[model samples]
Target: MGCCNAVRLNKCDEYPTQYRTDFIRTGYRPLPFSFKECIKSAFYANNETGNIWTHFIPFLFMVHRAYNVINQFEDLTDPINFGYYVHSIGVTYVLIASTIAHTFCSHSELCFRKCYSVDRAAIIMQGCSVQLVFELYICPPSCYVAEGMGRNSHVILTLYCVLSTIMFCSSVHPRLGRFQRFLATLPFGIGSIMINFSCAVRYLYSSNAIESTCFGTTKGDHVLFYFHLTSACLAIFFYVTKLPERWYPEKFDIVGSSHQIFHIFVAISLYFQNRLIEHVTAEAKFKIETGELLREPLASACSQTVGIFLLTFITVHSVVALYYWKVQPTIQICKPPEKKE
Candidate 1:
């Protein structure tokens, strides 16, 4: 039996390489350039401190979250499953795009503005993909005993992510300019509003069990709403007004920049938003399965909810900052080729 077990382990290890190679060939590479260059360019010249850290930090959080998912659900699923692996690859794509955008963006005039836009688009995709993967595990009724709640909640969350993705893609388009950015803001705004409104309606109609839970109350709902609102507003204002930094130009190059602030808030808000969903999903699952009161009070849940949000926010934001520090923009004014001097 011991010899048989040893042989089986060796065979299992060998099987994965074939699959891993397939993924390498077909899936997205995590970063396009050398790791050293990616880090170096992040702080070079753009003052893109927030942009670089935003994605970098989230990549770490995703690593942690992926681990938690594995530990928590070990029996029901395997961490090495294809769907799970592919989802992670998507995150790698986002990080690569973000790193590349930060690294080479300041290399040329064309690369500068384009990198910012590409980073924006990559973030949108990252946000959507995160929600999608979470849904795959939460949506099915396998874990939940209740029927209507699981299906309805899944549909609503999925729809919200889809709209958010569309809005992000449209709003971040390079050619759409300021006007398009404004239009793109609408979807996120609407989605945010709807989330609060639905929670309110759920409280009004649902029985005491759900209503009493953290997921339903207005006060509890505000935790997510306020942060998301602040984040989205900052991004919109920065893009539209082109504030302090834009007005001051060279003076704000290294710090005190509006774009940097916007990036920080956007990352923070995305973190908060995901936590809000995770809180509710975890609750909904418990409710459907046990049909008992939550282990913690609504208020306590709200606080935990907020903490998770900020934790994710800080980590991702740190990466954004470091990336920018390494890749500061090269500031040199052009003088019409200097007449061959």
Candidate 2:
């Protein structure tokens, strides 16, 4: 009931319709238009409080993990270690973007749309990063260049990045309806399924695998990989369905919402992924020490160039999306309509 830094709190019903999603229709609080006030609200109780903390806390853990990984493997020349470092960076960005989006989305309708675009871009970037790490692990530089499968995998990943960027950009188009926005995210979901399938196939044919430390060879590793896949699937299900909260909206307003559950599952899935990465990295190190395998070179120049291009494209796409959604008044939805009879 009291004010947070002289800014009064609002209830679910007070939220603008444009700001309300189907699952989060209530328990909303108004944020001050000022940047400082909106940021200060992160400390106070509100509808987005759970969402903000969920990713914010994880972002801190990610930072710590990144530091540990870099310190442990100071030699970034090792392709596997470098891949892990890049993955950590990607995960950190995802968490921070999610936190910022949830924290300030209530500031205004334009802010909400802009932040939503940033969150989507972060998701796409994280997905690409995951694929990059997995590819580096499963197919080192020599194998990637020598084998047709590796070449095909790289091409597929590049296409996924391009498609995801396009999808996110399209989702923000004013002409695209709400249903289109929902459909825009479907490609990434499908891409995830395809990626998992590829990993499974590679595991099944481990005898012919180029990498000695292929994941899913051991029964435990297989189970862990499947667990990670299940966690990811569950997160996606909750995100799309907006369950629990969708069934009982106001009851779970400040917490226990579907988005919060999705974030938790995401973290769980990443935990499993980390475990798998650690196991494979250890195995790779043991193999190298035993003279069973040699450390392959890092990604080739062409591969690195492609990666840089994709990163640049994603950056440009996010900038254009923000500009169109926030800075361009003509494209914004808040324009006053002409007088009607």
Candidate 3:
């Protein structure tokens, strides 16, 4: 949205009325745009310009962090280190999927649904990945559902996928109320927060609770965990309220939108979470170097994480495809808004 001249922008009347709902824009990208055009449009000014870059920039930044992790850390094959690798993948995929969806969503009505369908699936997987990381690396053992609670992780992951599938269907089936969609996605967030809260309770309240790594060595206080939770809740509030812009739509069509603010907070949240893991990993690595800790590789957790991603990935998109095939015929073109004159 930095550009003063926008060659690809078109009036809102030129696109579906859905573009007008809860969103005000000076112009939107033309419909049925090519993928190549979508990529090229990221450089130009349009309604979704900020949305595309907000997540994409963080995606690139995380890629750089991944590179740093590979070079600076030893015992790279250790499962404790490897589990965080899995979390990084989830963080990376979520941003990339959001960027892709934002970039290509204006292509057509079908395109919009398909793009966001993929985005929702990616988000569900991210939640599952977060759970896996918490179970294996972060949570103190004193927490009720801490590490070694493999069964709890499985049940929570299954519930997330089931509710997420309903949410996926809601994205494709236009008749589903917004409240229905909200309800479907609520379980995943609630499940994740419950696990985190258990850790928080153990850390904050229990006199015996110790901040420790998976290697069984106690560490310092859990500052990063608290920061992660704070940033995450801030991001969620922005997402739910659609703030500032909802109060003043005309002033925020491009740069200062709520979605953009949400993306920034999400990035910060991820940074805090990453640093928390890195701290634990650093301590574990030191012990390993001194011949005090052995790398177990926890192959089971790795396998389970991969399974959750594949199952959710296939289930969500499959329902999306079926719904589109059945409903495409009934979908109608946008009628231009009538002129006042």
Best by TM-score: 3
| TM-score of each candidate structure, all chains considered together | 0.49, 0.82, 0.82
Give a tens-digit lDDT track for model 2, residues 1-341.
24544555555455554565556655566543566666777777666778888898888987886677567764556555655655676678889988998888766666776777777777766776666666666433234223545556656665676666566655655556675646566866776865576666655555555554343255666676778889999998988888887788577777788889889888878767766766666666667778665555333422453355366446646565666756556634342223467
C-alpha local distance difference test of each model: 0.45, 0.65, 0.68
Error of 1 at 159 (Å): 11
The best-first sequence of candidates by lDDT reads 3, 2, 1
Candidate of highest lDDT = 3
> Looking at model 1, which ten-residue stretch has the lowest summed lDDT?
19-28
Clashing pairs in 2: 12-27
- Candidates ranked, most accurate by TM-score first: 3, 2, 1
Reference-based TM-score, model 2: 0.82
Off by over 4 Å in 2: 1-13, 139-147, 173-175, 204-216, 297-341
Question: Relative to the unseen true structure, what is the C-alpha lDDT of residue 74 in candidate 1, on a scale of 0 to 100?
Answer: 32
